[model samples]
Target: MSQFSTPLATTPGIMLVRVGQAGCALRWDAQAACWRWPDPQGGQLYAWPAQDSMPSGVRLLESAGLIACCRSGRVLLGLGKRLGSVELPAAGQSGRPLQAQVLATIDAAEARTVISDGRTDRQGNFVFGTANTGADQRPIGSFYQYSTRHGLRRLALPVVVAARSIAFSVDGARMYFADATRGDIMQCAYDAERAKVSDVRTFASVPAPAPERGAAVVDGAGMLWSVQGGALARYDADGHPRQRIELVREPVASMAFGGPDLRQLLLLGARGGLYGLPAGVAEELAPGVADTPFDDGPAAVVDSQRPHHGD
Candidate 1:
C-alpha cells in the first residue's frame, strides 16, 4: 500500500552504495570535491571522493553526532552538546586520523542531551539542534546558531523531543525545521544578514504510520526534499506535498545535493550505506528551479496546515 508507482529497488533511476554502519549528516564539500558525513552512533566521520565509492573514516570527539563542511575547509561537528571543527587529513595522510577542536560547548544541565542535526546557512554560519538522549527521550531539546561574528545563540522555538531535517529555501529567505516526534515540518522567515529566524509556523505534517523524519535539503525550485523512514518526499514552497521517492527498506539518515551541477541527490541510509539518483530525476522533480539565489526578499508568513497526502 505505497504511493510510489514502482518498487524502489527496481527503479533504474536509483543507485546504491554501502558506506558505513549508520550514515548521517551527509554533505557535499564542493571545495574539496568530496562528500562528508558522520556515523552518529558509530562515533565516526567519513569522507568519500566525489567520483569514487571508497570512503575514509576518522574517529570523532563525540560518540555520535552531525557534521557540516565550513567555508575554511574544516568541518564543523556537532557532538553531544559541543560544537567543534576538524580538518580532513591531506590526500597522503590517510594513515593519520583527523582530530576535532572544540569551539563552543553547551551545558545540558542535568538532562543528558546531545546534538542531533546540523547544517550551514547561506551566510556560512553553522546551525544545529539538540535533543534529550535520556531513556525517555523527553522534549527538552532546543535549536542554536553559531558564527565567528556572533558566537553561539539559541533560537526561540519551543522545546521538542528531537529536531531533524534543517534546510533553507533556494533564496535563503526561509528556513525549515522538522520535529521528528510530531511528524511536522516548520518554516520560518530567516534573515541571513542579522542571523535571525521568526514567524515559525507549521509547513507540512507527515501522515501517520511514517517513521520519524530525518535530514532534508531544499532544491533550486524552492522545493523541500525530506526523508522519513525509507522514503523521500517533496514539498513545494507553500508546503504542498508533491512527489515521493521510495528508497531502501532502511531509514534514510540524511541526504545532500552534489555533482558539478548540484543535481545529484546523495542519500545516507541509516544502515551505513550511500545511495544516489541520477540528476535527471531531480530535474524532473524540480523543473525550472535555479540554484540558491542571492537576492533577498521579505519573509512570508503562512498559516499552519497539514498538506494533503492522498491515500
Candidate 2:
C-alpha cells in the first residue's frame, strides 16, 4: 500500500464555521445544501453553506458553513446564502432541563451518539437520541421518524443504551449504529415502510470502550470507520475492526469522506485540526500527501432550552 505523508495545512475559512462553544456534529445537509451543527445553545440550530463569507455568531465557520438547531428544536440554516433559522415541526423533547443543551444532553442521557445527518430518508424521516448525563442517565435514548404521512412517530427500541453511533446502510434499509458503553456496533433491522426497528444484533464492538466517541460514516463501499483517541479505525462489513491508524494528534473528534474524487478521508481532530487519509479505493496512503489544516470552532455546546415537564 502506498503511504502518503505531509504536514497538515491549515484552512482559514474553517474557523468561520464555529457555531457552538464545543462543536459536536457536522453533516452535509442536502435539503438546504449546506453544512449544519447542533449549536451550544440548547434550543437553537445553526448552518453555513460551502465557502460563504463569515457571519456574526460564528467565529470560524466551515467553508461549508454551519447550521444550528433552534430553541424551538428546529434547525436554522447558517451557511452560504441559506441564512435563515426555521423550526422542524416534528422535534419533540426528552423532558430534560436546558441547563445543558442537546449535545451534552446526548452525551449524558442518550444511549446512542446521534446527530441530524441533514438528509431525511426516502420518505423524509430522521432519528435522534436524547443525551442523559447523570448517574441515573439511562441508555434508553428515544428514536423518532419524520414524514408527512404520520408526522413524528417514536419507535420503541428496547433500550440497550450506551454512547451510540448511528448510520444508514448504502441502501438506507439496514440501520447500523454503535453502543459505546458496550463497545459494540449494532445493526437494527429497520422497516422503512412501516417505520419500525427490531432485530437488534451486535454487528461490531470496540475492544475498549473509548470515551467521547465521535461520528461514524460508511464509504461508497459497505465499510465502516470511526475516530477515537486521535486515530482512525477501519471496520469490515461484519463490523470487525481490521486496522487502526493513529493520528499525530491526540483526541480525534470527527471525520468526513470527501474530495473531488471521494478518495480522501478528511478527519476532524480536536483542538481545531484536520487529517487526511486515503480510504476505501484509495486505501493506499499517497506518499508525501500532507495532512490538511483545520480551523477551530466552539468549545462546547450548552443546553438552553427548557425540558418538557409533561402537561
Candidate 3:
C-alpha cells in the first residue's frame, strides 16, 4: 500500500458552486440531475445543476437539516425534530410551493433535539442520527433506521453528544459513523438485509487543534473521505490515514462525488459555498474502488412509530 508523507503539497480546490445559505447534507440527485443540500439556517432545501449558477429552492421544510434523494425521486428531509419527505417540483415547475409530508416525529423526552446527519443503506433503508439541541450540549442523541416493513427502529449504540457523518462501504458490509463531540469515527459490520450493525470499532480519531470532524464518504475504491479541520483526508478501507487535500482556507462540512462520471469531488464549506477538486486526485490516491450508486428507493413507513428517546 502507498503511504502519504508529511508536508504534502496543498492542492487548492476551486469554488464551483454557492448556496444562498450555508449548506449541509450535500448529496447528488441523479434523477433530478442536480446536487441537493439543505440550508437549515435558511430553512430551505436548495438544488443546483452541475454547471449552472442558478439554484432552485424549496421552502417546504422548516429547519431542513439534512436531505436524501429517495428511490421514488422524492427528497427525504430531516426537519429538526421530524422526519419528512417532499416531492420536488419537476423542471420548470419551480414556482409552486413544495409541501412536506411528515413521516415521524422524534420526541426528545423534554430535552430539545434535532435530527442531524443521515443516509440510506444498500438495502434502501433510511438511517439517521440525532443531536441534542439543548444549551447543555448533552450527550443524549441516538440513531434510528426506517424502512417500509419496520417503521422506525432505534439502533444499539451509546448515546452521542453530537452525531455527524454517516457512510457505508461499497458492498454495504461496513458502516461508518462519527461523533463530533468526541472527534472519533467508528466502523461497524452492517447487515443490510436484517438492518443490523455489529462489532463497532474505531476507524479514526481526530485530536485537538484539528477542527471537529464532519460528514464522510467512501470512494469507489472503498477508501474513506472525511473532513478534518480545514482539509479533506483520505483513509484506507480499514481506517488507516493516507493523503490529505488542503482546501482554500474554508472548513468543509461535508463532501460527495458527483459529475457525469462520478469523478468530481464536491466539498461543502461550513462558512458557505461549495468547492471542487479534480477527480483525478481522488482516483490517483485511492484507485480500484468502483462508484457506488446512490440509493433511490422509495422512502416508506408502514405506520408512524414512536421514536425511542435517549436516556
Pick by lDDT: which candidate is best?
3
Clashing residue pairs for model 3: 71-296, 71-297, 220-289, 220-290, 221-289
By TM-score, how accurate is candidate 3?
0.87
Alpha-carbon runs more than 4 Å astray in model 1? 1-13, 278-283, 287-311
* Residue-wise C-alpha lDDT for candidate 2, range 209-293, written one tens digit per residue: 3443446666666676665444556666777665565545435556554434445555544444344443342455322111111
Better of 1 and 2 by lDDT: 1
- Return the TM-score for each candidate structure: 0.83, 0.57, 0.87
Q: Give the residue spans of candidate 2 off by over 4 A.
A: 1-21, 29-119, 160-163, 208-212, 259-264, 278-311
Sort all candidates by lDDT, best to worst: 3, 1, 2
List the candidate numbers ranked by TM-score, top first.
3, 1, 2
- Compared with the true structure, model 1 gives a TM-score of 0.83
For candidate 2, the per-residue lDDT at 232 reads 59
Provide the overall lDDT of each model, using Cα atoms, as 2-decimal numbers. 0.68, 0.43, 0.72
In terms of TM-score, how similar is model 2 to the real structure? Answer: 0.57
Instruction: List candidate 3 stretches off by more than 4 Å.
Output: 1-5, 108-110, 208-210, 278-311
Which 10 consecutive positions of candidate 3 have the poorest summed lDDT? 286-295
TM-score winner, 1 or 2 = 1
Indicate the worst ten consecutive residues by lDDT in candidate 1. 302-311
